[model samples]
Target: MTSAAPTPHTLLTPGPTPIHPRAVQALTRDMLGHMDPVVFALNRDIQQGLRDMYGAAPDTFTALLAGTGSLGMEAGFANLVESGDEVIVCANGSFGHRMAEMAARYGARVRLVTAPLGEAIRPEDVAAQLDDHVRMVAVVHGETSTGVLNPVPEIAELLRGRDTLLTVDAVTTAGMEPFHMQAWGVDYAYTGAQKCLSAPPGLAPIAVSDRAFARFHARRSPTPLWYADLDGLRDYWVHQSYHHTVPVNLHYALHAALSAALEEGLEVRQARAAHIGQAVYHTLEPLGFRHYVQDPAQRLPTVLALRLPDGLNDAAVRAELRQREISVTGGLGATAGLIWRLGLMGESARPAPYRTLMLALEDILGVPGLAGRFTETLTEIEDAVPA
Candidate 1:
């Protein structure tokens, strides 16, 4: 007996987003030794690409950590928070809460400034939690769990001119949204290769402002994690010194992905993301799915969390979609079993794949004309927006 052939999945999840064609092609290229001169050159290129995408200051230190986005989160806290350091974490969703937990684990005196799930964290609330003892303020630019985009700029303004450093988790917003680290007074920011970057997992791109670097340099205690030490990473990435074996193929893929993103221009890519997000929202609303994030301004265009219609079993629906070769994630933490987390990120943020997804959903939900309505609506949006 012959087994069934495997199917390709259209990934529409919060992370490990669809990889770009250029990145996929790069992954197939011959590998280079970790210490090869060409590898260092690729590191420089990746760092520069990150700086450009983040609008980082000229003196910023940028590098890629050989881990997932969670590692980036740990690096931010480990490098900056010393024992007894007062840190304010803005917890509006699951990612924000993770930062709070991580900060505490890193020996910080963690103070949580929280907002309800699906709502943007108020900058004033963060400001209220601030004190002279506060050493840093951590916020997630895009909360993947709830589809809420927090006001990082406003929160940065609260830390401006103060000794406090502002670190942002841009895991979902890195390539999808406009992020001006310098202008926004962000001291540190990090993202995953698997998100809007359109590269595969196993790399985390991080940016460190001079202010943040200085704080790390002044830490009385040594950083806890040897591998995550920014100084060691800097020596490896910036000074071409060996620290560990860098994943050469992932680097190649990331370099190609960044090159493609830059070639397309961030403004154009952002416009496309916005267009796709709106298209998804409009197409799904009439099908009984409701946006979990009530405020449109606070919603993430990359990852959308939608509350399922009454009587629909979340796991069963997701399982059905997966069987159809369409993969979207379910809600996380408190949102589990109540919502669906859909992503239209990077290479997946296009009309055709979403059309396929809609058609599949139509079939599953027994809605006869859903796909036609989606196509007509998308055409109207494309004509209006030119994405």
Candidate 2:
């Protein structure tokens, strides 16, 4: 017998998070020309929304680059790193290594301060590696691969009074976590529209401090190429001059997503995510599952990395969940075969996905009655929040 086309899965992976109906609706609006005044205004609104969310300084430049988060990562490096200059890459997981790789491609001397897969990078390790030649310091705010939130504020403080630029990869945590760009001293911060932003994948939103722009302005040579050049992007996004044609519809969608987040209030939204993440921990802990990141403070609210017990078939469990149109993921790199990654992001961070996913996990893992137990616990947690 043939089953119907698979139902829309509750997207529980980190990237390309579940988009809100409002954002999807925005995508269906009439397409505008890139040079249209309407699109220019929408693009400007998106950039302004980003700056407001980050609590950035007045001069901090915010814009949406065409590609996804990785493109922003490259742009961050391409604009700043020159040949033979030094950069400190903080590698506690996959994204950090990617930053280092981008720096290398731009001919910067790379120094890595990495922790184990499930641990956060130490601020002192970053401090110990600093020197006069270090032109930039790159760190991932949320290391999704390990479910660890790096100590970006502490790391930023370490770079205080130094001439080095501070760049953060906030792809997974932008809207879900508390963002304090001005107070945090982050020189250049970037996030993808896919994850916490809850928009369709494509746009890379970035915030750059004045100091970082000066470094780019004073570069010894022109930045690598036309597409991802920060200077050109700034001219178009900031000055409203025609640099390249943008994805007009996606900008509207991105604007919708950002506006929805801001309307909910960033602090309120972040607190809700925190509550939901705590609820997940409470629900899963009783079923003999242990989190990969031991320190609670180091964990990311968006992604849950769980360590299953012996004899459990990780693939089979994921397959069972997939059968029900649930889309939790597994680990990568050093964590392969050892963990399951359940993403609690944007729309998915609410109770519905958590309820469905926990029940499915109970059925797969043979945890009798634990799903019922989880429902009760999560209900109490949610009830505490004032609607």
Candidate 3:
């Protein structure tokens, strides 16, 4: 007798949301050698896709690093920072603090410009801390931990005409929202494939502006990390010389994912994310849930974090959802046990998955009409959104 069919799972966590079907198909295809001419063509296509996603200049350098988003973050600091160089890190959520920690490890004089947890960093606050000595300013476009969408464009504007370069962590916002690196003057930016791109994890796509590349070349000391060295990476990505074995299958998945994203249009995805955010907020508000981030403008539509009601058991609820094959994450670090992060990204940022979530929550919470309310809210949001 055949065993029972495997249970299907719905993923709503901030990272590694449901992989797009095209990417899944791509993953199952036959592999290619790292240095195959076909693989090189695929890589170029992926680079062009990334350039479009970030609105980068034609000459901006892009590469798919074989690691998670954190590697991209580290690479940004590893190449541009040196001992005794002052670097300003804008910190609000867990990821921002992680950036500060990474910068400190690189021997830079790390200056942290902070906001309260669950709040976005203020550009003016960052501006106030800037000085000629500050070599670079690092900021997060979407803080996954707290769902705060920091104003990178405004912060980039603040650094204009300064000697300082601006680096952005766009891990959660890249394909789901507007991110024009060239227009905003972002010197460097990076994102993971698992987030808005709806590809499998283990790939970090990065873009380096010409200015940032010049700074990379002008470093006072040799880059300490060989793996993350931008110059070495450029040799592999642009010059077609092997620095390491490229993850050909992962690139295949990313290529398909990018093709799907460009076909659907990024602005349409952004609107869908906004609709999801509104549906979640309105549907859960009646059940006594409130947003973790108070300011709507500062909240990320891609990741809506909600403060759990008093006396609610976070772990128990999440576990129940998990049992039903739905995955949602709880708070991290300082906000532990207080918030639930519901990711509406890429393939998961649609009505079907959200309806599944609402039904499960209704069953767990004993709210008789929660699912119906969610459907109504979703309808209202869709009607309001212009075609």
| Winning model by TM-score | 3
What is the full ranking by lDDT, best candidate first? Answer: 3, 1, 2
Report how far off residue 282 is in candidate 2 (Å).
Answer: 2.2
**Candidate closer to the true structure by lDDT (higher is better), 1 or 2:** 1
For 89-168, candidate 1 gives per-residue lDDT tens digits of: 99988889999999999899999999998899998888789988999999999999899989988888887779999999
| C-alpha lDDT of residue 260 in model 2 | 93
Against the hidden true structure, what lDDT does model 2 obtain? 0.85
Q: Which of candidates 2 and 3 is the stronger one according to lDDT?
A: 3
- Show the colliding residue pairs in model 3: none
Off by over 4 Å in 2: 1-6, 383-387
Q: After superposition, how far is residue 191 of candidate 1 from its true place, in Å?
A: 0.5
Residues 316-353, candidate 2, lDDT per residue (tens digit)?
88888888998877889878879887777788778777
Which whole-number lDDT from 0 to 100 does residue 5 have in model 2?
82
